[model samples]
Target: MWAKLVPGKAVATPVISYMLNKAFTYLVNYWRTEDMESVKAELLKMLPHVQAVFDAVDWDNIKEQSAALDAWLWQLRDAVEEAEDSLDELDYHRLKEEVKARDEQEASGSVSKLKGKLIRKLTKHVPKNGMLKRLKESVEGLHKALLV
Candidate 1:
C-alpha cells in the first residue's frame, strides 16, 4: 500500500510543529468549568508529553526514512483531527448557551442603555464538553506512536 507523504521539507517541519503546538496550546488554555475539570486535566497532561516528543524529533534527518515518517505523520494528523472535533463539540455547547443568554436578556425589560450589553458579551471568547474519553484515547494513541 502506498503511504501518504508528509511535507518534510526544512520549512515544513517548523510549520507542522507550530500547528501542532498551537492546537495543544489552545486546548490547554481553554477555560474550564467544574464539569470540565477531568477532561481539562487529561488534555493538560497529554499535550505537554506530546509536545516533548514532537520537539525531540530530528526533523533534518527525517527524509532518510520518508516512508516511515509519512506513516507516522498521517497517524498524527488523524489524532489531531479527532482532538479538534472533540473540542468543537464543547464550542458548540458554549455558543448555544451564549445565544440563549442573549435572547433572555433581550426579552427582559431592562434599561434601554443595557439593551445591547448582553449581546456584546456574546462576542467575548467565553472559555468553554465533548467526549473526554474518546479524546483522551486518541491523543494517547498518538503518544504511543511518538514513542516509537
Candidate 2:
C-alpha cells in the first residue's frame, strides 16, 4: 500500500509503523481480513494529504541540499563504475579487497555505533541561536514517531 504513494522520508517510518500496527491490531482483535482495493484507496487519499503538508513546509534549501547529496552520490557511483571499467585483473582484485574491508567495517557499524557517531557530529555541527530550536523540532518529530 505504501509503495504506491509518496511521503517525506521524515514521515515515512512513523506512517508505516502506525499503519502496520493499526492494521495488525484490527485483524487480530476482530479476525477480519482486508483486501488490497481498500488499502489502495486509503493510500491514494494519503498521498495527496502528505503532498500538501510537505508543500506547506517552506524549506529554503532542503531541496537543493537533497539534490546536491544525490548528485554527489551519483558522482561516487560513476567514479566507482569508471574505476571498475579501467581495472586490470590483478588491480581489480586488490581494489575489491580494499572495498571489502571498508564494507565490512560499515556493516559492523550498527545502529548504536551510528547513534554514537551522530551525537558527536551533532555536538560539533549544531550551532546556537534558532538552529538548536529547529534541531529540537526535528528530534521531537522522530521521538514522537518512536524512531529516536
Candidate 3:
C-alpha cells in the first residue's frame, strides 16, 4: 500500500502509516459498538487530511513521520491510562522525558523529515481534559517548536 502513496521512493511513514492505520483500525474495530459507524466516518475524513499533511511536508515527510511517532505515543498513553496503577509521578515523568527527547530530536532536525506525521501522532492522543490536557499541552509545545 505504501509503495505508491509515498513519493520520492519508499520511506518510514508508509511503514508507520500502514501500521498506524492497522492498529487504530484494529482497536476501533475491537472496541467499537453502536458508535462505530460515526467513528469510522471520522477516520475516513482524516485520510485526505492526512494526505494533505503529507503534501505540505515537501520532503522527508516530516508531518507524516512525526504523525506516526505521535500515534505510537498516544497508544502508550491509552495503555497507561488503562493500567490499574495509571500514570504515577514516576511514569508521568518518564513520559515527559520521552517527549523531551522527541522535541529535541525534532528541533535539531533529527526527525524533521517526518514532521507532519510526527505532529499528527503527537496531537492525536489529547483526551480533552485533566491529565490528558497536560500531555496535550506538552505535545502542543513540541509542535510549536517544530514550526520555528
Candidate 4:
C-alpha cells in the first residue's frame, strides 16, 4: 500500500479516503462496545486536520519547487501509514477473537454457549492498553504532522 505513494503522484486523496473509510468502519463496529471511544474520537478529530492539510497544499506544485515540502508530504504519508497499520492491527485482533469464539462454540456443541461465551471472548480481545496507546499516538502524530 505504501508503494502506491509515488512522490509526484496524486496519492493523498486516495490514501486519506481509504483511511477515513477504515476509521469510520471501526467507529461503527467497535466504538462503544470495545471501550475504544477515546481513541476513536481522537482519530475522528484528527482526520479533518489531515484533510485540511491535504486541501491547503497544492502538492503538484510543491513537488517541483520545494524539496522541504516534498519531505513534509512524505512525513505526512508515513503518519497515515502508521495510523492505517494500527487500525489493521485492531481489526486483526477483533477477527481473531471472533473466530476463537466461534470455534469454542462449535466445540461445546451447544447453541446457547454462544450467548455468554462469545460476548466474553470478544470482550477479552479488546485491544490491549498498549495497542490503544499506539493507536492514539499514531493519530496524535498525524495531527502534529498536519500542524507542520
Candidate 5:
C-alpha cells in the first residue's frame, strides 16, 4: 500500500532500511566480514516483516490507540535507533582501520612495507568480537521488539 503511493519506493523504508543499505555498501566497496554475512542475512530476512508492520500502522489514528500500542511503538523506535547507531559504529571502525592501513602502506622502506603487511594481516578490518556481539544483541532486541 505504501509502495503504491511512492511510485517506485516503499514509504516504510525507515532507519533499518538505511542501516542495511549502508552495511551492504560498506561490505561491497570497503569492508568484508564473514561474521557479518549471517547478521546481514538475518536483517534482510526480517526487513519485509518490519516494513509490513510499519505500513499497517494507521498513523492518523495512532494518537487514539491504546497506551500499550503507543509503548510498543516507542520500543520499536528505540530498537531501530540503537541498530542504526551500532551500524554507524561499525562503519566508523571500518573506515578508521582502512585509513590506518593506508597510512602504514604509505611509509617508505622494505621493512616498513613488510611490517605494514604483517600488521594488516594480524588486525584485519573485521569487526572486533565485542562489537559483533553488541551488534548481534541489537539485532536480537529488534527481533524481540517485532515480536511484541
Candidate 6:
C-alpha cells in the first residue's frame, strides 16, 4: 500500500491517509446507492465544519504537552477507530449484495429484460438508517465538541 511509500510518523501523512481511507471506503460501498448516497451527501455537506475543527488543532502546541493530552487523545482515537470500522463494514455489505445479485442474475438466463432488472436491483441498495443516524450524530458531536 501507499503506507510503504509514505513514511510512518510523518506529520501530515497520517491525517491525509486516514481521511482518504474513510472517504474511499464509504464511497466505494455507497456512492451510487440512493439511500446511502443521501446520507453520504449530507456528511459531505458537513465536511467544511469538520475541516475547520481539524484546521484549528495546534499540533505544535500539543506536542509540547502530549503527555497531558494523552487521555483526551485516547478518547478521540477510540472514537475515530470505531468510526473507521463502521464505515469499512459498508464495503462488506456491498460485496455481499454484489454476490447475491450475481447469483440471482446467473439463475435467471441471459435475457435482455432480466439483465436490465438485474442492473436495477444492483443499483438500488438499501441504506442502513441506524448507521446513517449514528454517523450524523457523530459528526454533529464533533462539530459541537470542536466549537467548545
Clashes of each: 1, 0, 19, 0, 0, 0
- List the candidate numbers ranked by lDDT, top first: 5, 4, 1, 6, 3, 2
Please write out the lDDT profile of model 6 over residues 1-148, one tens digit for every residue.
2233223334433463455346445545544344444544554555565555345545555545455454444454554555555555655766777777767777776695487576767776544756645544443343333333
lDDT of 6 at 63: 41
Best by TM-score: 5
Q: Tens digit of lDDT per residue, candidate 4, span 11-122? A: 5556665775666565545443354455446555666665565566665576666777778778877888898888888888878877887777777756668575867756
Question: Candidate 5: deviation at residue 111, Å?
Answer: 3.9
| Candidate 4 clashing pairs, residues 3+ apart or interchain | none
Clashing residue pairs in candidate 6 are: none
lDDT of 2 at 132: 28
Among all windows of ten consecutive residues in candidate 4, which has the lowest summed lDDT? Answer: 1-10
Candidate 2 residue lDDT tens string, 100-132? 545655776587557655654454322233432
Per-model RMSD to reference: 7.2, 19.8, 18.8, 5.3, 5.9, 7.3
Give the clash count for model 2: 0
TM agreement with the true structure for every prediction? 0.45, 0.20, 0.26, 0.64, 0.66, 0.51
- Name the regions of candidate 5 deviating beyond 4 angstroms: 1-46
**Clashing residue pairs for model 2:** none
Cα misplacement distance, residue 52 of candidate 2 (Å)? 4.3
| Least accurate 10 contiguous residues by lDDT in model 2 | 139-148
Error in Å for residue 12 of model 1: 7.6
| Model 6 deviation from native, Cα RMSD in Å | 7.3
Q: lDDT for each of the candidates?
A: 0.53, 0.40, 0.42, 0.65, 0.67, 0.51
lDDT of 3: 0.42
Error of 4 at 72 (Å): 0.7
lDDT tens digits, residue span 13-104, model 1: 34434444444544455523344445434544555655554555565565564767656756776765665666566557668867776677
